[model samples]
Target: MKQTRKPPLAVVQISRAVTVIRFHVCLLFVFFASTILATLPSNVLFTSTAGSAVRMPINIIANQSFGYFTKPPQSDQIGLYVRDGDGRISDAMITPQSKYQNFLGVSRRQRTQGPEYAMIARLVGSWTDCNRGAESCVEDGFRLSAFEIKTPSPMPTICGDALITSETPTKWAYRDLVDYQYIVVAMAHVKVDCDSGVFAPDIQTRADGGE
Candidate 1:
């Protein structure tokens, strides 16, 4: 009988090396993909008191104003607002409140009577419709349940001019310098959903902080 010939040792070694390289490349891709998803807005299913699951929209405000101002000037007071699609501003309330409220209070105290400082925040909330024939009607009302805040560097264009100027005091509107919503949609490489009014981020750009 004829003896079977074996492949060269060098060729086998090269094949093993190639397989190992492919495995590592796959692992790297998975790691990066997961990282990006973590940074992007996740669709968290939040249940309302009525036992219905509601998907709240997570909005990124690149540069806006926040304050803890009240009539009595309480040390633990905080308030934030965001503009909705209808051009109406709504309250963006934070949960587990005291910690964040105190932070804002301290921040305000440190810069008392100075220019309003800018902030970047990611807010997760839902909008509630106003009741018909109510005593007071607020259009396009939103209530935020969760939020993350960061101080912006190289503030946005709208922030350049102080919200409250000596010439025209009593202004406390929160505005953005750029079209942040548009920017976020573009960065995510996703188009705006006209029906849902949501900007969905793609997997690759999800992890980016968008700073």
Candidate 2:
């Protein structure tokens, strides 16, 4: 007796169907996971870029605290300075009209409109804008304080967690994360000028990112 063989077309079609099903199953799994993550609290979802289980609920408390302590908003000129871990300092002049001032109430100085002013504004805004403001100064918009931004070092943190060391060596701690590259200390110093008008030294400490 002769045995019957399966058709080549049938075999090929079956194989293709299996592969397609697998691909779709994987896609669905990923989609469902991402949706669950989106529903979770920011702190929990943010714990690990990929992990699903979270311990803390994400909240705006930290940001709210910053806004509370920062000086009240006002209109004026702003000075920005940046110092790298290498100790190099760069400066930018900003006023209520400059397009690139990142902090609140900063923009092109009204009388000093020019390409340089535009360039400086762009640079400072790109670095940080914790103070909050739109690009380029607009009507009724207050300017950032020059004293708040003119320094190379970050603003000092008088409170919050402190950095300490121990005589006996111990495992690195999550608390020690304050030294993480992205974490920075910044100080805002504001000054009023009759010529340049009011400005602030906004100090920023940038993240090294270990790159």
Candidate 3:
């Protein structure tokens, strides 16, 4: 006697539906986060009811002289990198608010103030807690292709700046300045889909933090 096998059409359909639902959920999360992120304070970048939060160890440098140095730090220091949905790297320093806006191009028509920039800014402010003034503040003069990853998040932690030195001889280069300091901020954004995603087909601003 031969046994007959039946097709799992119902199971297949159910699986497909589940996949679609998951994709939608992810899409919704990304969209909501991106929109609210731009308007939110850096302190509260990832506090959602969904119970997903990423704690990044922002490098806090205190009471350091500000100037252009020819040598890298003797000891390891704090640095960051910014990336977009396409994984393209930007070698911009976001320590100062002006640099953040100008180098990252947060204002005007040519700026790449994507998720990474917003995240970095928020983190820098929170790390420094710069309420009174620029004194005893935090600034990221060092350049990093990536960070040390002391702790990892379930979701990708979008860095506002890259913190590795392999890519560039110098992570940060100071112009003819002798008494300037700034706090570093960083962030990143990943697209759900390019062909049918809402955030896709978007253009990043092209400002080098220079007016």
- Per-model root-mean-square deviation over C-alphas: 22.7, 20.4, 22.7
Q: Please provide, for model 1 over 84-171, each residue's C-alpha lDDT reduced to its tens digit, 9 standing for 90 to 100.
A: 4565544333322244654845443333212122122111122223322111222212221112212232222111101110111111
Instruction: State the lDDT of candidate 2 residue by residue for 66-178, as single tens digits.
Output: 33455543323333343334644343333344345534435324335234233223333332223222112110112222222232212221111111100112124643643
Candidate 3: 10-residue stretch with minimal lDDT: 55-64
Give lDDT for model 3: 0.35
Give per-residue CA lDDT, model 3, range 1-211, as digits (tens).
9999876999889999999999999998875564444333335544433322321211121212222333455333233444455656554443433555455545442223334334333333112222211221212222211222211221223333343211111224542342333332322122112222233223334223311
Q: lDDT of each model, Cα atoms only? A: 0.29, 0.33, 0.35
Off by over 4 Å in 3: 1-7, 42-211
Q: After superposition, how far is residue 94 of candidate 1 from its true place, in Å?
A: 42
TM-score, cand. 3 vs. native: 0.18
Task: Identify the leading candidate in terms of lDDT.
Answer: 3
The per-residue C-alpha lDDT of model 1 at residue 97 equals 25
